[model samples]
Target: MRKELYVYHEGKPVQAVIRTYTERDFDGLIEVQRVSFPPPFPEELWWSKEQLTEHVVRFPEGALCAEVNGVLIGSMTGLIVSDEAVEEAHSWSAITDDGYIRNHDSTGHTLYVVDICVVPEFRKTGIGKWLMQTMYETVVQLKLNRLLGGGRMPGYHLHAGEATPEEYLERVLRGEWNDPVISFLLRCGRVPVGISEQYLEDEQSLNYAVLMEWRNPFNSSSL
Candidate 1:
């Protein structure tokens, strides 16, 4: 196991280890997505096996998985993109481009985290934090300036009929409300940069997302 990426869940050491994905982990990736993310977002929202396989081929290092007892329990998928790309509004499918990931620009200075899923059983075990920290480490390794993503506001579903995203965010920041995705990102030190409408088909986020960023505070170049 990689001590650098160790984690704990539910009063026990998380019997999982994080690593870049390999060809064999594809099925586990699908299973994690299905089991971790609950319904109503439409099955189309999930990554197809072909798409995930191609992504692993294109940017192996950007696709990470947490294996527990040899079963894949978590996944974090990302694509390298230019700073300009992230500045624009993008849907999950648009950024991923039907799983082709056509926008993985080598010259880009940002890593766009397209998806991060952990099985329901593994939720709240610090697994998400470990995955995010690993993402930070990846940015430094790749010499990128930051990590950028359009993250779901899972708590928005309940308030979408009454609250504007702006109002909702205010509540989240005030601690008057709690959003699983937003709160997790907050724990990872990611800052909300903007509001993106129609970001994903997720009912939880009301099809909206928050543009977030985590700048590398310890890039090797700085040292």
Candidate 2:
């Protein structure tokens, strides 16, 4: 699928194309991660050629990237997973097969999003939402039960001294607090199913993650 979007870059609107990434886009994808997640975010967590290759070969439809003038600026990756994987508390590495996504189940009922990133400059340009909308369409087209993703509590570390992760989550749910990642997911129409400990190595989240899910409205089973 291909979509054309007018996104703001440097205060000027530029056309961007969203499409399923190919093997040739690996370098661009890697570059996006490098710029999107920096410092505290581990460099080792960036996408690798092997992982990108596996994504294209195993589930190309779930791997998408946005480009402007042939330069990639954002990407979102997902792998099909069974309900059992969604029900259980699994770390990012486990569900995504340590980034290789070898555990992708073609018969699975859920589309488990692994990662999403937009370069700092291009953020808030509606690129992320457009990417998510594309995946939502994929879920409906494939008749998947829901869209699931683990969200980091990037703002939790700041409130760690005042509240435990659980308490912080409650506050966020109650609208008394806003967590960068969790709040973003909530705004995207996902609800928190639960929390996963050590879901990722994110320092800002204190290694904790919120299980975010957006059920497919057209799927009765999802309801």
Candidate 3:
């Protein structure tokens, strides 16, 4: 599915396209992750050739990229998981098979988002939201139960010493605080379902992630 939208580019708006990822997009995708998650974010955790290859080959529809003027600026990756798997709290690595998506099950009922990122310069221009909406569309098209993901609490470390993760999340839900990740998830139509510890290795989030979900309105089973 090719989706077109306008995004800020060099201080002006430019047309951008969102479409399924391809083999040639690997390098561009890596660059986007590099700038999006800079140093201290574990450079080794960035997208790898083998893992990206697996994404398109295994579940092409789940791997999407956004391009502006021939340059990839953002992307979202996903894998299908069963209801039983979604009910269990799982780490990003475990759920996505260490990013290779080796466990992707076409018959699974849920679309599990593994990662979503946009280049720092291109953010706040609706690119991230568009990528998310595209994934939501995928859930509808596949007639899946829902879209599920573990959202990083990048802003939680600041409140970690004063409040528990749950407490901090409460404040965020009540609009007392705006977590960079949680707030964005809420804006994208996802609701917090629970918390997952050791969800990722990111030091910024202190290995904590909020479990978020967006149920498909068109799916009767989800209703």
> Each model's TM-score, in the order given?
0.89, 0.94, 0.96
Q: What is the C-alpha lDDT of each candidate?
A: 0.80, 0.90, 0.92
Question: Model 2 compared with the native: what TM-score?
Answer: 0.94
Ranking by lDDT: 3, 2, 1
Q: Name the regions of candidate 2 deviating beyond 4 angstroms.
A: 9-12
Rank candidates by TM-score, best first: 3, 2, 1
lDDT of 2 by residue, 29-59 (tens): 9999999988777888889998999999999
Cα deviation of 107, candidate 1, in Å? 0.7
lDDT tens string, model 3, 4-118?
8887767788999999999988999999999898877788999999999999999999999999889999999999999888777789889999999999999999999998999
Enumerate residue pairs that collide in model 1.
none
Candidate 1: how many backbone clashes? 0
lDDT of 3 at 136: 95
Checking candidate 3 for backbone clashes, the offending pairs are none
Q: Between prediction 2 and prediction 3, which has the larger lDDT? A: 3
